[model samples]
Target: MPRMLLVTVLALLCSACSSGGDRYDPPGLREVTAANQCMEQCQRHFDSCMTSSSSVDSSDRCGAGVATQRDTRCDTIDNPDLRKRCQASADYCRNRLPALTCGENRSRCVSRCGG
Candidate 1:
């Protein structure tokens, strides 16, 4: 009887341990993710544009021009609210890109995007 009771208790404990909670994402997460992706694309485009527009010595001027173009393009997003959020995220990325390493930049942008 003691052995049977022990087995039952163990089974109960195992079942309890295996109970997986709901796996739902928080609200606005999808939107934020989309905006982050868009911002990354914009940044890549800006980098490419800068590379083609000027030599290494003129990088500062090129970067400024590219940033302005990126902001203009990002700001025209169809959804006003999303455009604002995306532009904010893009601005964050632009401001921090020169100061942070690649991994840190990604982490900071993700956090800034509300992820």
Candidate 2:
């Protein structure tokens, strides 16, 4: 009976340990969905800025502002996967930003956030 009890306890202890796939996300690590949502909000802000009647900000200015906003929100993500994806998108969009309109820039900027 003591041998059986020890075996049962050992089995329970082993089961309690986490395996490779069961690992939890690190603290402050944002999920990919969160990244996507953040980018969506950034796009909305850019759209609003572009349509606003304020003459102080040009379309190019709006594009720049949204790019800043995107980086501020998405670039700071703690998750490595999300950060890598966001940076790649930002790089791709920024390179073409000078040639594209604000709306076009926004689309490219948020493209990679989606899983």
Candidate 3:
């Protein structure tokens, strides 16, 4: 009778111990989306400035503004994947700013966060 009681108590304890495992919640969906949208808008403004204005100074100022916005927004993102995407887009824009002509070739500035 004691052996049976011991077995029942052990079973109950085992079941109770296994009931409260940790649950994981994946992050970065909403924040990443918002960051990407904001970066896109900044990119468009930079592109518009590059295309319409002949002043190199103005374009440089616009590029700096875009870079600042991108960095600020991406820094707020918690997920590494999403943050990398935002940084990549910002890097592309900053790197390409000097070479941008009057044309609208922004394929290189595209954000990879959607993936």
Candidate 4:
């Protein structure tokens, strides 16, 4: 099981590295679809993280916010309490994103406790 898990993990990493796309773009006309995709990806990643923390799963949980943070109009926080504040900011971004547009996305983000 562990060996299969390792192969799956490696394959995921390689695919992620190769499947490059314009991640910064808004949802275009299909905001809901785009948000759903984002939300699905986030959920899958978070679920994998819950099952496995021996690798980049920790980063996956938080990295799920990358899309949200990019979309939100937040200024970079100063270094007063850098780590916590930045994480909080990311959390907020994730919450505000996929709210009304994508119901599934919104629910998943909420359950993820990103807000």
Highest TM-score among the candidates is held by which one?
3
Candidate 3 segments whose C-alpha is farther than 4 A from its true place? 1-64, 97-115
User: How do the residues 18-48 of candidate 3 rate in per-residue lDDT, one tens digit apiece?
Assistant: 8977878766789778768866865786667
Q: Which sequence of candidate numbers ranks them by lDDT, best first?
A: 3, 2, 1, 4
> How many residue pairs clash in each candidate at the backbone level?
0, 0, 0, 0
Q: Which candidate has the highest lDDT of all?
A: 3
Measured against the true structure, the TM-scores of the candidates, in listed sequence, are: 0.30, 0.29, 0.35, 0.24
Tens digits of per-residue lDDT, candidate 2, 17-92, equal 7444566766454685588687988678677655652444333344656655667778579998998888666656
In model 1, the clashing pairs are none
RMSD of each: 14.2, 16.2, 16.2, 23.4
lDDT of 4 by residue, 29-111 (tens): 67666666676777676565444543433334446547355434334545547645666766664444322324454466755
| Cα lDDT over the full model 1 | 0.63
Better of 2 and 3 by TM-score: 3
TM-score, prediction 2: 0.29
Write one digit per residue (lDDT tens) for candidate 1, span 8-29: 9999999988889677876697
